[model samples]
Target: MKKLLAFIFLISSFAQAQYTINGTMAPILESDWVILYKIEGASQKYVQDSKIKINTIDVQGKKQKIGTFSFTLPKDTEAGSYRVTYKLENAGYVDFIFNKENLNFGFHPDYPEQTVTFSISKENILYRKYLEKISNAQQQLDSIQITALQNPSLDLKSAYQTSLNKVNSIQNEYLTNSKDMYVAPFIKANSRNNPSEILDNPQTYMSNIIDTFFYDVDFTNKTLLNSSFLIDKITDYIFYINYSDDPNTQQILFKNSVDKVIYKFKNIPYKKSIIEFLIDQFETTMNLELIDYLFENHYYKLPKTIQDQKYITSKRALFATGIGRVAPDFSWIENGKNFKLSTLNDSEKYVLVFWSTTCSHCLNEVPKLHSFLKENKAVEVIAFALEDDEFGWKNYKTNLPNWHHVLGLKKWQNKIARTYNINATPTYFILDKDKKIIAKPESLEDVKTFINKQ
Candidate 1:
C-alpha cells in the first residue's frame, strides 16, 4: 500500500509541473506592456498579456528604465513555438521555443532579433547555438562554391569539402541532441541539400541547388505546419531563388516560383494562407500587376469559406485606383455647362491635383506648380480644391487662372476626393491620354522630374 501511494504521488508531481517565460527589455521607450502568443501555422493564438514593470538601473554611469514582464504557463501548456510582442513597429517581437521549460531572456526593443539573449532556457540556448553554427558553416560553403565558380583555375576543392563536412556534422549533431525536444522538427526542416562534390559551372551548381531546395523539408509535418517554418521557407523559395535583370523576365520568374511553391503543399488551408501572404507582400510593394495575377490565377479559385469576399472587394477597389488602372470619372458645373473629366481630349497627358485652400502646404506648392506648368503645353492641370466652403477657394483661384479649377465642398468628405482615396492635401496624379493613371508623384519636385523626363 505504501509503495503504491508513493508511486502515485511522484506521477502527480510530474504532471503538475509549471513553466514560465520571463522577458526583460532595455530602454523600453513608449511600450508599457507585452503580449504572449502561441504561433500556429499562419496565425497567432493569444495566450496572455502582462503590464511591464519598469526598473531604473544605472548602466555606464547613466540611468535607464528596464522593462520586465512575464507569463506563467499552465502545467498542460502545449509545447512548440511562442512569440512575445512588445510593439508593432519594425517587428518588435522575439520568438523562442517552449517545451515544459522555464525561459528567461532580455533584449533591446529596437533590435530584438539581433540583441535577444537567453539566460535560463535549455531549449532556446541549444537552438540559438545550432542556428549560429549551422549558418556560419553554410555561408562558408557558399563562399567557397561561388569563388570556385568565378575562378575555375583556383584550387578551392579542399576548402569547399571542409565547409560541407562542417555543415553536415553540425546539422547531424543538432538533430541528434534535439530529437526528443520541440526544436528537432525545425532543425530537420531547415537543413539544406549540399552537393557532395564541387562543380566548375555556375549554371549547373545553381540548377542543382534549385532542384534539391525542398528535398529535406517535410511539408506534412504537423509541427512545421503549426510554426512559421513553412511560410518562411515558401517566402525564401519564391523571392530568393530566381533573379533577372529585366523586369518582365523577373515577373515571369516570380510566377514560376509561386507555382512551384504552391505545388508542394497538399493542404488547402496551407495553400490559402500562403497565397494570402504573397498577396500582402506584393500589395505592400505596390506591385499591382502581380496582385492582379494572383487574384485571377489563384485567389479567386479558392472555396467560398476561405475566399473572404469582403477582403477581395477591398483589394479590387484598391487596385481600381492604382497606377495602371483608369482614373475614376467626375463632373463639375462650369458656366452653366456640365463637364466630365473623361470627355476632355485636349491634352496628351493630364495632371489631377487634390488640394485644400486651408492647407498651408497646398497654398505654398500650388502656386509653384502653376508657375512650373505655364511653359509645358502637352500636359493640362486640373486642380480640385477640397474645402468646407467656397469662400477661400474662390479667393485663392484668381491668381492661378491657367489651370481648370473645381471647387469641392465638404473638404475631406467630398465625393471626388474620397473616390481618389485622397488622405493628404496636395496629392498629385498624372494620367495618360487614355485616362489611365501613369504616375502618382510625391512632391512638386517629383512632378517636375516626371514632366522633364517625358
Candidate 2:
C-alpha cells in the first residue's frame, strides 16, 4: 500500500511540471506591467502568476529590461500558445509555444515584431524573422499601391502589382520553410494571394473560402484551440470574408461554420467557449433568432454548471422575447384602478415600456415618449417603472398624467420585468390592439419609424 501511494505521488509531481520563461525587454518603463495570457479555446485568460515586472538592468552605459522579466509556468499546465503583452502603446504582444519547455528570449519595446530574439528555440526565431519579412513586404506593397493610386500611371501600377506578387511569394516561401512549426498554420491562414479570381466574383470566392478555411486546420488540437490564431482566423473568415447582405443566408452560414467547429471540440472548456462566442456574436449582431438554435442543441448538452445554466436561462429569455409572442399579462394599480395589460385600452395600439427612474436613458426617452403619445392619439403608453421606491416614479409620473403609469416596486425582480425578460433599461415593446408583441424597437427613433409606417 505504501509503495502504491508513493507511485501515485510521483505521477502527481510529473503532472505538476514547471516551465520557466526568461526574457528581457529594452526601452521599457518600470511603470509598465507585463501580462501573460493563456489562450483557452476562443478566449485569452490572464495568468496571474505569469505577470512579470519590467525591472531595469544596465549593460554598459545603456540600460535594458533584459533578465529582469521571468515567470515560471504553473505545474501541470496545458501545453498551448502563451502570449506576453505590455500596457505601453505600440509595444505589440508576442505569442510563444508553451509545450512543457522553458523559454529564453529577448525583445525590444520599440520593434517587437521585427526585433524579437529567441535564444532557446530556432523555431521561434525563424517564425519571428518570417513575420518581420511579411510585415515589411506588406508595408512596401501599401506604399506602392498608394503611389499608384495617386499617380495612376502604368509604371506605378506595374510597380504595385510587382510588390504584391513579391509579398505573396515571400509568404509562400516562409510557409514552405516553416512547414512543421506551430506558426506555420497561422502564416498559411493569414497569407492570401493578391487580386485573385476571388476579387472578380466575391460571393463565390467568399463561399469557397468559408468551406475550405478549416481544411488544413486540426480543430481538435488542444494547442491550436488555446491559440488566438485559430479563433481570430475563424472570426475573420465568418465575418469579413463571408460578408453577405442577405441576413437569412448570412445566419445560415454563420451557424453552419460554428456548428462544424463546435462538433470538433470534445474538450468542455473549448466547446463551452466556442458556443459562448457564437452566442455573443449573434447577440451583438441582433440576430437573436440564431440563439434559439444554439440553445436547442449545443448549449443544453453542455455540463449544467452554474455559469452554463445562467447563460442558458439568459439566452432562453432573449429568444422568447422575439416578435409575434403574446405579451405576458400583468396587473398594475394606477389612480386606485386595477389595470391588466391585456385589458388596458384594447381598442388602441399600446407601447409597453420597462423603464427605471434611476436610468438616465429612461429619463431622457420617457419624456419624449410622453410628448409623442400626446400628439398621436392612435397609441397609448404603458410605462412600467422598475424601481425600489415609489417616490421617483410618483414624481416622474405627475408630468405624464395621461399615460398608464405603474410602479414596479420590486425593481428588476418585479414579476412583469422577469416575465418579459427585461435585462436593460428603457426596453420597449410595440403591442397590437390585442396585446400581441408586433415589434421590439431599439429606441424612440425606431418607435417613431414603426408608427410613421402604420
Scored by TM-score, the top model is: 1
lDDT of candidate 1 over 232-351, digit per residue (tens): 788777778777889999899888888888777787787787787898888888888888888888888888788888788777767778998889988998658788898889899999
RMSD of each: 4.5, 8.0
Per-candidate local distance difference test: 0.88, 0.74
Candidate 2: 10-residue stretch with minimal lDDT: 193-202
TM-score of each: 0.83, 0.63
Point to the candidate with the largest lDDT.
Answer: 1
Candidate 1's displacement at residue 181, Å, is: 2.7
The residue pairs that clash in candidate 1, if any, are 41-226
